[model samples]
Target: MGELQVEKHVKYILAVEKRKDDFESVVMEHLRLNGAYWGLTTLDILGKLDAVDQDEVISWVMQCQHEDDIAGLQNEDGSFSGDMWGEVDTRFSYIAICSLALMRQLDKIDVGNAVKYIVSCKNVDGGFGCTPGAESHAGQIFCCVGALAITGSLHHVDKDLLGWWLCERQVKSGGLNGRPEKLPDVCYSWWVLSSLILIDRVHWIDKEKLAKFILDCQDKERGGISDRPDDAVDVFHTYFGVAGLSLLEYPGLKPIDPAYALPVSVVSKVILGK
Candidate 1:
């Protein structure tokens, strides 16, 4: 099944690479941390990282870093402001860090200042915000937690409060919401579940129901998951949908390392330099 998924991903990457779309163009220009992370992740899964210029790609990714000590930014502007808390988001920061780590350039980053920025994003509500002084969100919480875990600063987080906030994200349907009042979605299943896994609190959530809800979001005939029931299927949700289920130890899915946010299969190869 892993081999088949890799083949499917290779074909998908080929098709996407051939497209004359804005997605590819934007990724090249911005090297947006998330986009690069996704691209490299998929390629790594397919054992095709050599197809990309590792050095050039790493250089571009570093350029996206904000001099203001934030990890990812909406634009190259160093203004330290934006709609989502007027600063770089912790979510983007996690992706940026992961991307560099995948490329073995994690040492190039200012770990101390990056940790400071991530710490500042933590909200009193227990979850981390996209930026300082923003509302707590599940997605950003995953970012902050994932970042801290990767940087070996997990001890800095308030584990009790963070776990409480994550548990609060669960809804009757077993899906999770980014914020207090938003509707539950499959994406948060990844955010919240991953956070729980990192904090050793996975057993605290209803894994059975969460797995059912995530499966329900799948397009049975189409073979991909959507963000919500009846929504169009896309790559983003597809990846997280599988990942969310993987977290619950779903029978046929690969196990994802919550701390690094990568499938154990791929991470093993990375760590071993295989």
Candidate 2:
């Protein structure tokens, strides 16, 4: 029954922008990643991009060809590592593929093998995991499905099965949890909803109820969203909350491409060079 505090949310996001020379707060560093995804995507989606701090937006046209070490992250089996330290996960696959795709250099990596690696992480329960033989989870499903969608390889997913798995994440309160028997969290609205949308199964969930749930988690007066109502608000959950509302077709918000996790218009420019 609550409404999205659009102006308040925008102010909250802008209020948290990391000042120059700030390197101590881990929380600030997080929302600032990916050229301040929280600020850019939220501002862009909310039609408030004019309020963005241009210098805070780092549009890196990173070199990822063999010259830049994207290939080095790939293992023989095709999964990618988070970095030189070699920690592997479907999360890394999404990060690597999404990064390269935005750079217009997806071909620099082995697409066929990358798809194979992501597919291997799929479980019979119809959801994806962090690694092969790992437990299925909503966040992992988002990463794997997003990677597959970006690469034009979604056929590798079992849509019907995965859709059912994702559907079960919604609790009686209308909020979604990451996995079975877990408490619902605002973040899953982005994870589970985006994955369902990518597979053409978004309608299976209760849109109105989920939207109400997300709205209920917002700090309406101060402008930020939390994982649950009555909890502390942070930019991370605010990012997911606003992005989820966009996916739900909330009025006055722009559409975001579920796969790229960017405003749809921005994705066209980033990937298609439009």
Q: Compared with the true structure, what per-residue lDDT tens digits does model 2 show for residues 1-274?
A: 7788999988888777745355534545533464366666788888998887565354332322235467679888899998788899999999889988888888888889999989999998988899999999999999999999998999889899999999999998899999999999999999999999999999899999999999999997899999999899877788899899999999999999999899999888877778
Off by over 4 Å in 1: 1-87
lDDT of each: 0.70, 0.87
**Per-residue C-alpha lDDT of model 1 across residues 147-249, encoded as one tens digit per residue:** 8888888998888888987888888988888877789888888889999888888777788888888877766554455788788755566667666777777
Off by over 4 Å in 2: 18-31, 59-68
Best by lDDT: 2
TM-score of each: 0.72, 0.91
What TM-score should be assigned to candidate 2?
0.91
Give the TM-score (vs. native) of candidate 1.
0.72
